[model samples]
Target chain A: MEGNIYKKLLEELELGNKAVMITVMDDKECGEKNCNRKILYTEDNIANSCISDLNKVVYEKAKQSLETGNLEFVQVNETESYLIEPYFPEPRLIVFGGGHIAKPLVEFGARAGFLVTVIDDRPSFANTARFPGAEKVICESFDKCFDLINLNRSTFVVIVTRGHRHDMECLREVLKHDTAYVGMIGSKRRVKGAMEQLVNEGYSKKKLDKVNAPIGIEIGAVTPDEIAFSIIAQVIKYRRLADGKEEKKILSKVNWPEIDRDVLMELCEEDSLPKAIITIISTKGSVPRKAGAKMLVWSNGKVSGSIGGGCSEGEVIVKSRYLLRDREYEVHRVDMTAEVAEEEGMVCGGIMDVFLEPFWN
Target chain B: MEGNIYKKLLEELELGNKAVMITVMDDKECGEKNCNRKILYTEDNIANSCISDLNKVVYEKAKQSLETGNLEFVQVNETESYLIEPYFPEPRLIVFGGGHIAKPLVEFGARAGFLVTVIDDRPSFANTARFPGAEKVICESFDKCFDLINLNRSTFVVIVTRGHRHDMECLREVLKHDTAYVGMIGSKRRVKGAMEQLVNEGYSKKKLDKVNAPIGIEIGAVTPDEIAFSIIAQVIKYRRLADGKEEKKILSKVNWPEIDRDVLMELCEEDSLPKAIITIISTKGSVPRKAGAKMLVWSNGKVSGSIGGGCSEGEVIVKSRYLLRDREYEVHRVDMTAEVAEEEGMVCGGIMDVFLEPFWN
Candidate 1:
């Protein structure tokens, strides 16, 4: 909260350490007494209070979430519910070619919560402004970018360059990597040509089979936006539906982000800031954000991230002050199903299960 | 519209006729005088006013939308704007199993504007209450239900039955039909067993290749809802993409939906109730719905569908009444860029271009 919990989380993510953030979601009856009672569990350590009964309850669920690699909501008790949220630094889209289609693909990817990195030979094609929301924009040739980036189980390589040769080149490099998905945008004829040549060059039929050439779901999309939608849909399909068949990474213990972990590292380095990480693990009905949404609460009333900003969040903020004091990892529920929600000007009318866990490195 | 305009449209759709409905999307500046200028064009015929100068302009754009199979915003005249919207009886999700995963899949499908239909052997498994928003719930075996339904270019067939045998049975049957997608849920081992048996039994590799066995995207989904997320994502992928390559049907010239198509058809039939079909063909900035969102403006001050119901829509309704009276087909612009937009309680701070074409078929 004081420095950067996000950066610290990213650091933990780098170490390939699976993170299970447990939160208490009981907004109504629990009051502010048990507001900030949350816990964090890693493979080697537990943060906040992971020794309580809820820890035992959440541990198994967290392990399951880790195994499945999906976010879920669980009932901890009658009035209290816990969200067993697993953070997997998976589903990264690396788009080759900052073309028209890349615009929407990057935008959609970011919105769908994927870290999208775009590469292009031209500066005009690959710029921060064009892909404002994208994580990274590399203005370089496909060959250069290909050599620079890492291709692993989490990587989804998209070949949508301006020309066919570039696409073929990107495809060639991607097929050899530990990439989870490799989709190249091309006509049937063009893809056929590439495949024929690659096959002749001794690329295995199985390797060639991995590529989703003519990338996209094929809604007969014509425009860039429409085409982008198709491609993203296909990516999501591959990301979620695969049967352990794609490039999965060999994790290195204690992995961390090389850059931009400054804030979180700063927070971890500084012990004075007594903060709690509040994650919206599970939601029922209508809510602003889906599961896995997080917010950091500081004892002095500072916050980071957002679990939807409204009177509801304001209430959570107030509770964070008490929870930080109590150090109780309580499941707090937020019922925005009434006129109170309407009066609070909440867009979604649903219940939210929040877990406010005190932070510990 | 007289004597089932909805029926006529349905008839056209049945005949495999693609229709494009064009509208103007400016909600701020263009008042109701330019509201009712909408035109509907099919593969062979034109509705509303096709002979006008604007007809030529919209004709090309509409044709483009049809070819692209997507909704888009276009510039009609230098000053005028139009939205070339294609009416695709799209998002039809057909679930072969009424199992655990199918529950959330159906629910999500319905929410995502899909006409969902669930098929199961057990009566309890397939029921209206289980899938309230679904168009149909068939309480019969896969064979019985498969024989009853029409598998077309738009049908997204999902197989998530109880056991491996049921999954294989559904997959085998689905492979023969005209379906946009066919996904079956199973463990890797089970899927392998089915594949091996089907292959040994002389099922062509080409035919079996279409199935998305071990259905849904691979998000490590453990729970039913999480698993459902992956499946729905795959279905949506197939729905939006395919580029005439994936089981695009050889249309019967005139095809029709056996269920639904009530709204547009109803509008067409009520000659006494003249109306304008307003579709948000494209969008910019932050709006509630994107392109392809629609609303029906009736002469008697009634409306159907929604193009983001708020002050913005309220303004469109008022303008629609005027356009209906004037019989004008004007491409008007709506600018919600000013503080007036925020002051008027508009959630999105952007401009919309609305086409108000008089409905005279």
Candidate 2:
């Protein structure tokens, strides 16, 4: 009976089905000469056997299976034991380019228990030595590599090549596949150029929209490792989205009035209160916030949102007021490294480019 | 003057101080004839000034300086902006062992901007080639390495050695240092054995109390990488604790009534109503929750917490009742890879181990 139940569970799991099992045992049967035992398996429908207090046993077994993703057997007295096998599948990481960033990417990905694979046209770049953790390293062109690997919905694709052209070639091929995530590393201008080239090549704008160009949420990443983090973070975000998990938003859930046309016009007016607008254009490394995450500070102690909290925010606040007083529209770059942000207890080693502009009446 | 300010900020930070700078700029001095120009540096005990209205200018300058960690300033503003350079020290990750896990540890630490270093006797494991991003990797015995590296009041140490003896060796070395955190991975038996050995070696109870043995917050991590994550998480927790940040507790903070002696005795009675206890022992790969996170199920469709939500939880719920009916304690393992976790919408590729036991009356 246990063997049959295990076989059934394995079959359902392999077929991508869910199930729950319940066992009802008689306590008196344990000490009695001839006692009957009953076991029930509930796949899509409910299955039961002749047992005292059947409803209670069935309800519990069903609920237990549902709550813990486990299978078990329950006796009438709730004291016997049985086994249930759960179905789980392996994870895979599909990297598009095999470059310097990809080198660490493969290693980290493999160490993270991702079935890693590397693909590149250049055999020198894509090889076993370059990516030891990569299960398969294919020395095929970008166009052919897609066919070689099964790019399913479970696959995670990262495009880190020599330059924009190769990145675009890989992106085009990956976009055709049913991949869960697709990330390409490049500058905003470069990404824009790549998009235009793809559009010119007759790829649909809808298909292009699926790609995460300038890949990774903008953290103003400069180093290869930092860039890799941004890409990985984006991939994780995509996974959460695919799984329907809500990503934590920096902004509070408060009901802020939308910016009106009048407010915009007033802000643009020449004769308005001189306001220092400090906008974070980009961020890299261990920054408190990502590229688009912002903090607005007024000449007064009033503040909104944050680039990073603690000392970083306080320092930015002081600078904004100075910019306002001096009437200077200057750009400042802040590097948050161990040596710099340490006193503030910030370990995010990131560099942020902030543009401070004066808008006044 | 710049050197003096730098020296002052460093001194203040060394004493674990916090200060805010206010800059008040003098606009009239720059454009007016025979106008007095000045700059001011103010602290709690001292107020030094070179000119009037220097507060605004210097404050702005200091704020920008603080952002970039560039303490020096160029005279871009005619008003002479005051730059505030707040001294902030970065957090450090002091890894006690250099093994397979340490390779990823150094990579993650460097990318996360922690001043990472590996201490191991094996030269191959602690070489620069293995840990390129690590600020330092000391290939020395545990005792010698502890003396060489400065374990300050904010250092986070993680012990991941090949065996219990090495873990004990490192633990002994660290106990004397004024480190913020120390985490070691092993089974309860191994941890108890190590602690016994340490006690026998004359280590004080107070010092042993500081170590988080059988660590990683009780998460049932089986694989090396999973164990690495659990250890890293604990280190991160301690890092936050050092910064006075609250660590997020996994279980919901619930209010429970104090039980009287009579109530406790009554609860333990044999004829009392039976209860069901469900615990998640271990999880693998991309499961929603890590191991050791659990939930309890009652007969009335009521539930608390979760193992992994969705169809997986639904299955667990079903099996729970069966265990209650059978009056049996059973262990169930579920693998929810590729298949959706019921309607909870989690696509985690992993296996989960759950134990169902009858709650004694």
Candidate 3:
């Protein structure tokens, strides 16, 4: 039954659909035998849910969780709570220039888990050699690029062409589309001149104001790489924090934890039996990875993915090895406080409540 | 004589000496045929100089330029001006712990032109495979790493070890030396606890106050790559703008413009002759590169370095080709304003006064 639920999740995720996977952490008050039961919530319906009676309450919380894109533990009743993990497709970052700044921008954007696309009129600059991390590199003119890529609410656009005319052209075309982010790189005077030109071209002041001109946060970035860093930082802020009606799609994890895919697929295939799953259900302060981050520990001490790699993870893996031997399910608290560091050598800087479930069937 | 001067400059730079290269922009008011004369200022004396008559004034201005680390046009008289460009050795970035965050931090620090070194206790994590950008990677305990590397006023230390104890240990050792910047990655509570422990061990609060605890700028960086970007941005701010006595070494150009080295070496070897040297002497508004950025355009249209690449540079190259045939030295202005972009194809958004000189000897 757990394998079937995970298989449904993998299929939904593969289809580029948003999903909320709810796991009952404690079911002391629930009448149904729903403790450790997994329920998958899609946009329209629920699947593989054992707790049909609690679907109304669970649906409300899942909807809110999807809206906020937060992985958290929500109280259901007197003593029961559920871990809600929201998953969304990777955001698309379309850079409209393959210049100096665009190179690092592509690298950083891809590293931050944005599916990056580089579009430039020059074939020399817009090639796979230049942007190895970019998912697509289109050597086409600025005006012609609009027809090539899909622009939607989850798409981010950055204009960093060599000339102001090219910048304006890209801006004009990008402004017509619905995008999660739009940033153009230029000097303050250049930004003003370009904005004025757009305003003269009948672009509304309110619409043009949404463009992140002189793109990037004010970290006093002077170099091309620093500018790229600033731009991607701003992009991440919008991806994670922006909650506007127009930009409601939020992604909690930049790069999806590999273990979530690899181990879950292994569970679906009935191979790699006796694997212990460790998911961070809740985190206090300054943890490495956030809640919903998962890792799979095998019987032979091999592991996949990370929950803030270091001594704390080592301690958890040690306990998970023991859990795989005797326990079917357990809620373990990993403490990374100074007191713990002094006593048992746990080195992280926060506290995390993790759900450990062993699958041996 | 010009080749000899360039050779001397290269020698000084190779030896990692701070130098101020002064170029006379105009000699209309100055005597001694000082127009286009080159002067090199070291700490104690001047070398390869033809403007001995104006040494006192030039020396005074050169001293100020070295201290401020600014490339600017200094007026010597009513009509004559000099371009003061300062050069310093690469700053050293010593990263303790070759962990996940350390990977991107090393990449960013190295990309920002810092000589990076990564140290870790675990040999598996401390290797070239993990940190290819790092100049050196050492597999040694944090307590013993202080003896392996040199730490001075130009050194920036970043502590990102796996554990709080390691963070505290690295901090204690790092504080013993004088460094330009010191940043430690940890939670606010962990930092507070570590600082308190250091204070208990007789370290001054003022000294501890200087450390960039919870490292990186407040851009709300969540991922490791974003965190690395924020930290590198702060590092660049210190390297380019910090004006403290302890952090006096300022570097304007992150990566030494490749054209500066490759063409200067060509000049040193007398291999690239009949080359037109374009040096940005002054800038008005927002320019791609700052003053003192150079580009060498040859008679064959081959080039080295850049003065802000694109259509503006292309225009300069065309002008430089004309200059190589019929001109000795000319002061040309490349304007990237909207008015100029509308009239001509000059696409940048700023103004730069470039001194073009043909080196044909």
Candidate 4:
């Protein structure tokens, strides 16, 4: 049953649809109410859920995760614990010119988890050989690219055409799209001229305001690669969704591909036998990895993920097997500051408290 | 003479001294007064120069470059063309706590060209084994770190300690240093409380205003790595000296180490051979490398710097040798958009205009 639910989740993800998965972790006191159950939530509001009252919490958490695109640990009514993970579509980076800056931009964009697309009027400029990382290479006029690709809120567009003529044409098309970020690279005069023309043509000043003209976080980036770095930095800045000031956003853990795939698959399996899962709950001073890094240990000593693979993990692994024998949920303190840490051939010099919990069907 | 200049320059850099180098690239009409010349500019005002008028321009450029550490191309009196390279001491990054965020910050700081140091009271938290990239790792009390290391205007300090008490203590120490940037990580309330305490202790509101509290650019970065990215991004934004809206800075090419060292070394060589050097002056559309990239071509087919090593370079290399035969200074353009670019097993899909300059000592 969990497999079918996960299959749907993966399918929705592949289709570029948004979703949230809720997995129950603890049900020690909630007898026979589908303890340790799984639920799936989507934008359609039609979801696979269990245990009333907990479903309301899942719905609220699911909605919140959609905004942040984060994974969360939710305490469902104090007795039920659920881990809610959001699934956003692969981020799209649409480049409106296959220019010099676009070269490194595409490379950086791809490396930063964007499905990059390069659009140019000349076939020579937009091709696979130059942009191997680009998901699509559209060699068409400036206006044609808009009609070709789907530009939605998830799409990040960078306009860096060769001339003002091409830049103006692309600006027209970009304004029409429902996009997340729109950055145009040009001199102040060039960008202003393009924007003024668009405004004169009846486009709202508010619409033009959306564009990050003279694009990027000004890093004194002069070369194409430097400019590329600045542009990507700005994109990440926006994607990270920074509030103006003094707003300490509660950050979600890293969107680990390994965890999304491997852990999800493992959890979906119909393994009635219990398995110990270790999560770094707290940390201090020079830890190799951060909190949110997880490691799953089996009774047989096999493992998945890493809590900074060192003597600390070796100790945790031994303790995890012991945990499996006792079947007691415990918090294991790993202190890697002693001389033994150096002797173990590790560089970590911090203390971490890991919560070891076993999951059973 | 050039070697002594560079050795002095490097030594001054190690000592955190600021200086600038002005190199005369071309002077076709300036009589027999050395076509390729080098000049040094420092606060001592000692300079070995040919054109006194050009010396004024060098001084002005040097002063501006000092404010923003950047390499500039200066044209003096429309006749004396020079490259003014600014040399400041390696920017120092001093981390007050060797915590999770410090790990990635150290790695990123090293990659972004900063001499880093990690300081903490716990020997386990602050050690060489954890921070291989750090120039110094001080395992002492937070207050003791300041007395251990020299904190000058070129230093950037980040405080991310285990406790608010330690963070405040580090902040108090940091405020005493003449620093470039100061950031402290904590909740807004924590930072406010620290600042209030400092204000009560007679620190001016203006002085406390400089601290980037709750550190990092508002990227809702939660994980240590993500938070590190935001902090570094903010550091760069400040370092690059963004002057806010409409003042789009004219960025120079990337401070390429190879170009800086090789070109400087090559110019310093006493060889009187009329060597033809190729410098990428301008580029457009999908070129492998950016403008300001160089390729020093000798009389033979040997080359030093790379402007994307492919068939495009092969063509440039061939053209470079041809220019050497005639010993003529010319701007030879290489258009890689043609079909030949593909046939040459090349990936470049842009045009590059290279300045082929012949240097005669």
TM accuracy, model 4: 0.58
Report the Cα lDDT for residue A304, model 4.
82
Clashes of 1: 84
Native-to-model Cα distance after best TM-score fit, residue B8 in candidate 1, in Å = 2.7
For each model, chain A TM-score?
0.67, 0.46, 0.65, 0.65
TM-scores, each model vs. reference: 0.45, 0.39, 0.64, 0.58
Candidate 4 Cα deviation (angstroms), residue A53: 11
lDDT tens digits, residue span A240-289, model 3: 55522244354443333222566566657656467788889888876777
Q: Candidate 3 docking category?
A: incorrect
Tell how far residue B219 is off in model 3, in angstroms.
4.0
Q: How would you encode candidate 1's per-residue C-alpha lDDT over B181-275 as one tens digit per residue?
A: 78888888878788889999888887777778788755545457556656666665555444123454522111121222444655556466567
DockQ of each candidate, alpha-carbon based: 0.10, 0.02, 0.19, 0.19
lDDT-superior candidate, 1 or 3: 3
lDDT of 4 by residue, B171-246 (tens): 8877876577889998888788888889999988877888889998765565676677677766665555532211
Clashes (backbone N, CA, C under 3 Å), per candidate, total 84, 89, 1, 4
Model 1 agreement with the true structure over A1-361: per-residue lDDT tens digits: 2334445456567654556656555545544333523455665565443466564666676665654555666775676666665666546789998877898788767755578899998887889999997888998877778666767766888898877878888888888875667889889998898899999999999888878888876554544655676676666656555522544442212111112233344445546577776767568887776666767788888777778777788888888889788766655898777623352222448888887776653
lDDT of 3 at A112: 80
> What's the lDDT for all of these models?
0.67, 0.57, 0.75, 0.69
lDDT of 4: 0.69
